[model samples]
Target chain A: MTVSLEQARIIIAQTFKKGSELGLKPLSVVVLDAGGHVQAFEREDGAAPGRFAIAHGKAYGAVMLGMAGRAQMARAEAQAYFMSAVNGAFGGAVVPVPGGILLRDDQDAVIGAVGITGDTSDNDVLAGLAGIAAAGLKAEA
Target chain B: MTVSLEQARIIIAQTFKKGSELGLKPLSVVVLDAGGHVQAFEREDGAAPGRFAIAHGKAYGAVMLGMAGRAQMARAEAQAYFMSAVNGAFGGAVVPVPGGILLRDDQDAVIGAVGITGDTSDNDVLAGLAGIAAAGLKAEA
Candidate 1:
């Protein structure tokens, strides 16, 4: 019933390693357990300072809604009023955008999520998906 | 993987309802998506002034570690030297204790987490579990 922190750390480390292997810039990688809690997080050296929290925020937003943040961007654009209302409703917790991906088990249930920053939003999303896959989890397209 | 403001409000409401039904004191409930970012949070009317932030910090720590904050007490105790060195790691994010629980789906994937304050640790954990359950998610033991 518990998501092992050690495993999470290992997965995060692997994620960073993958990022390095890809010759990408330093990244902040974050992992969250199914309950939408942080399982393990690491901000690579030289990565932007605020990217850590921003990546976390983006990923958290995605997991809560069971969709990608980027998908919500269109909704936000069409419903600015509703989006603004969400900002007030969550006291500023909502941030529907990309750079995050949900982690799923073999059974296809969302078990956790990964988020990455310190690169383009597209890059972040790719990195997050790679990290989840490295951990032997799947990501919904 | 975003945690919408609406989801946050729903989680908080569930947490407060569980507390009131049990005749507990007013509580502050915080929901964080996977990646250790705040999603939605609320402190019941008449709750302690600082309980909101404190509960959030603790929940952030819990989710980041993918375990209950209470569970991290031992690690924190044994790794005092290291813990102190990173005392403000994650910008004061490590709550490493039992007052929170991770949110997981049917396959045991972590989607988010909830933390509760204004009651005993046992009560807080109970309230969090109730909130996760209310959301139709499973809580790690």
Candidate 2:
């Protein structure tokens, strides 16, 4: 499954709208293509200074490592030292957090990822799923 | 003058569209606010590696110094040692080239800057100007 940049923009917008309407905190959202490169990102006016980097990092880690960020957090618990070294090697481009979600197609193949920030971990995850749905893209199991 | 992330994204998209219409090389465009922080950025498919850095660097320099990149190049010519040392100090975050342009408001206040890459310096400047116009913003004189 491949994701185009236009779809990525739509996903980000939808994520913002849904998150805002739900009374979630201002957010920064990032969408990456299958290759783990940024397609589009948006940070709301009141989003924190580091929100963009965190949001993009989460999506980058999910797409590059082929696992959702929350799953990576679980692994990070057991291999904290190794994960830290690896993250250092990559200049800190990964975030092991619940906001990262893999986007999929009908065939169940991963196509891209979305990362949302500025809300609780659970709410961020919900925002990612909502964005994917708004874009009409499936989510990986 | 202030540049919203929405306007920044629009400017980037317009830059790509105009560059394509002109049959230029693959391009990357970046927009930075008055504080020289990345607001929105995009790298077209097939854009060369480092294109994003160059684009962002150009805009960062423009916003940080409140001058168009061409003016910065003129300064560079007269102060090569100073330019080199400054760039070295900042790890090359400043690109003194023609592609960076300052965005202004009705009062002629500097609000943001846009940097364009992947073509001749002159064409890059033209693309930046067009993008600013497309976003309904005036270019700083």
Candidate 3:
């Protein structure tokens, strides 16, 4: 099933809330449907202007490639040209970072993805996981 | 001055509310800072997958060009090549359409823009106007 608008909003809101609670920098979050289309997005007050696009690219890469962000990063390092070609094909939407997480349904099928920015990649991933858990969804990180 | 994150959220929320009240199709709304960076965006549950990009392009074009959607459309018709060049320059973030509006402060300085899509252009403009009014901001349409 596709992610509803309410679920996307919850994912964004909770992501920011988690970031705040953890004392991370202001965060930018994006939620993308399985088709790699944006469902919802927000950038906190002090986040840099480019954070939104970076978050979007990370989530788009995860949803479109059916891989977790960590895997994408590993592959990018092992096959730089391949990663570049993929990013070019997708109009540069693949960030290949650690902050993108796939959301799974009860059946273990990918339903959507969330990407977070404005902190270290590891910290970003933590916030994403917290948001996914709060939304009652499983995260494939 | 730039549009704050809270103001951007309010604009998107109220835009969707107005669309719902008018019985319009599920809409995609985007808010952009004056620098043409995304502040917030959302696509309603039933909105088309591409609606988010369309809404973003509309708002980006408005903020980048410092013009209302009507003015952009008129210019696009009068100078198609120029419009194409501008879109190319912005990496295709400029959409000449009726749903884009420039948000102005009390002194008539542009602070941001809002864009809506998924309904007829006229109805989209109406919803955007209503949202801007509700947000207590002036719309340069």
Best by DockQ: 3
- Provide the clashing-pair count of each candidate structure: 40, 0, 0
Model 3 ranges with Cα > 4 A deviation: none
Assign candidate 2 its CAPRI class.
Answer: acceptable
TM-score of each: 0.49, 0.87, 0.97
User: Candidate 1: lDDT of B57?
Assistant: 67
Kindly report which residue stretches of model 1 are placed more than 4 angstroms away from their true locations once superposed.
Answer: A1-3, B1-141
lDDT of 1 by residue, B1-141 (tens): 434445555666687788999888878777777766655445554565466456776777666767666666667788876655554767665656667677776666677677778888788878777776766677763
Give the C-alpha miss distance for residue B10 in model 3, angstroms: 1.1
lDDT of 2 by residue, B46-137 (tens): 66646767887888888888888888898899999987887887778999888988998888889989988899989888777888898999
Evaluate all candidate structures by whole-model CA lDDT and list the values in order: 0.66, 0.81, 0.90
Off by over 4 Å in 2: A105-110
Best of the two (1, 2) by lDDT: 2
Model 3, position B137, has a per-residue lDDT of: 92
DockQ (C-alpha based) per candidate is: 0.03, 0.42, 0.87
True-structure lDDT of candidate 3: 0.90
Identify the candidate with maximal lDDT: 3
Clashing pairs in 2: none
Residue by residue across A58-119, what tens digits does model 3's lDDT show? 89899999998999999999999998999999988789989989999999899899989999
